[model samples]
Target: MISVKNISKTFKLYQSPSDRLKEIILHRSYHRVFQALNNVSFEVKQGETLGIIGENGAGKSTILKILTGILMPDRGSVNIDGKITGLLELGTGFNAEFSGLDNIFHNATYLGLSRNDIEKKLDEIIEFTELHEFINEPIKTYSSGMVMRLAFSVAIHADPNAFVVDEALSVGDAYFQQKCMQKIKAFKNNGGSIIFVSHDSNAVKILCDEAILLEGGNVVQQADPETIINTYNFLIAKRSKGEDIRYQGDDTSSGYGNYMVRIDDVSLQDENNNPSEILISGRPAKIVIRLAGEETIDDLTVGIGIRDKFGQDIYGTNSFHLKKKICIKKGQILLIEYYFKEFNVGPGKYTVSVALHTGDTHVNECFHWLDKSVAFEVVAGGDDIFIGFVRLKPDFHIKSETGNKDD
Candidate 1:
């Protein structure tokens, strides 16, 4: 078990040269401070995988550093009940001049293993890393990913009581990534607590049971994986649209309220303004949602989910923040519109459904299933010229250093 209480971190960064010299020579501080974590607190039980997610500067890495004892927190305390082994940075504990064999032993010792203890697991670590040929080479010659693989191999081979992993695991190739997942799974099954940090939503869903969302140096929401990811996606959409947003789930202790809002109709149209189920791949497509608002609907948010034929949600969007509330009088019809940048969805029979939820609480209420909404066929053109999702207009130019002979 781990308990974090009012943990905060701030760094004083010098902007001006005079300030830096004054702080060094006269012991006078003249630097602006940046706050990374502000009164952030959370707990993780034994054998539980807790995920930390947020935007680029949301203090995710700062919290991990504090937890691992790599950086001391400016305020608050982290009460860890067990020994922690962190995989924060690639080659963080490695000496570039040392051979892989020597580096592994050194790093393992730093992780609290003695020489004799690490020698027993040396063969296993080399095998796990699959670096048989390069095991004796100097770490300075190794690629970034190779160093990561070897470092990870040594860290997990010792089997600490707790593991803290950042987004560094993606450094390895797909095959080695799968191996890392298996090792983490084994660690969890053996009652080890884990704190995983990643920006990949699918990774969070696959790995964590509970998660915490942080934004602007504040703990926004902490809940189940599904709920956390839903809130995260909504935040991403809101931020992309240049809006200030805050969303919280309904208080569970207040009991059940069955105020439902369901999607009544979904239709697709092309540029010609004709009803068409089949949409072209490299064109424009529009999704229209017709909903009958039940009860007094205040600030109703609508989301359109576009999935592949196999039911994996590729991308989605919604009116996460409009600055103005979409209050629907009881029994009033509401039309919600979602326009795609371009119809870049590959040729396939895709299904479209709408979700109506409260703006404050990103909780889904009514379920609308349009099994076979539209069948779209992409008319292909250009040989491998356009790639993935939307296609952008590009300009190519050629400049001549020498003018024409006549000139």
Candidate 2:
């Protein structure tokens, strides 16, 4: 378990090296103070995973460094129940000139393992990395992903009571990432505490028990993974528009945009055009998005995303993909309806996320984006028995043919 209380850190930035000398001589302040973290506090109990997410320069790295003892906070305190390890960045605590095998021994020894203990766990670590062929290769010769594999392998095998993982896990390939996630899950099941920092919302939602959002060195919100991720998205949208940043606090829906277009309302409807919180599988349904224009805009593409209860995206599409372009003038109210002839998804609770942007994606010029605007459940009444999140309407054919028997 890990506990952090009212932690704060600040850095002094100088415009030039000469300013430091001048400040010392004149006993004057010649550096600008940058608050990297301010009163940040959180806890990770045994068997729980806490995720930290924020934009760049929001003190995510600073907080991690403090938690891992790499940097000292100017105020507050941190307490760890047992040995803690961290995977902060690629090649951290590694000697570039040393071979992978040598680095394994080196890192394990640093983790408080005896030579005998290192020898016993050496093979297991190497096998987990799948780097047997390159175990003797110099660390300088390995790729970034390879270094990440070696580092993560050694860190996890150190048998730490709690581990802090930054964005280092994002370096490896998808297969290795999945392998690491499985290992993390096993560790969590064994009552290990984890503090994961990443920009991957889906991974955080799937793995974390709770999460916190940081902005400008302050903890903006702390809550369940779903709520944190929604607020994070909203924060990004607000940043893109140069708007004042504040926590929306509403988990049901968080909306943000440039104000040129506003998502006034969103609703899920059934075949009879009645609002519904429940929909039937393989039945006709529609999502109605009401938009009010604050200014004239062209090249607008409206999109919708369907996410499962776990926050995994099921489907997403935009008007650009459908070859539709919209233009709205000031005071114009538009009602966009997406009709589904067959909602062929399995029975489950899902949410509808709507966005109004330019071009094909919301990466640039996002006029409005609303997350979890509406929610509905799909029932199994109209569809055949299916076992997964989606129905493919598979067609099967059986043919009988007799072939010559082999001698």
Per-residue error (Å), model 1, residue 81: 2.1
For candidate 1, give the lDDT of residue 275: 71
* Global lDDT scores for all candidate models: 0.74, 0.89
| Model 2, C-alpha of 116: deviation from truth (Å) | 1.3
Q: In model 1, what is the error at residue 328, expressed in angstroms?
A: 20
Q: For candidate 1, give the lDDT of residue 213.
A: 98
Q: Lowest summed lDDT over 10 consecutive residues: which window, candidate 2?
A: 243-252
lDDT of 2 by residue, 1-407 (tens): 89999999999999999999999999999999999999999999999999999999999989888877889999999999998887887888899999999999998888788999999998899999999999999999999999999999988999899998999999999999999999999999999999999999889999999999999999999999988887787777666656633333263687766768888999989988899989988889999999999889987899999999998888999999999989998999999999999988889999999988888876567787788888899998743788788877776655556644433
Model 1 CA lDDT for position 336: 71
Question: What TM-score does prediction 1 earn?
Answer: 0.66
Evaluate model 1: give its lDDT. Answer: 0.74
Q: Where is model 2 more than 4 Å wrong at Cα?
A: 16-30, 244-251, 271-275, 360-366, 381-385, 393-407
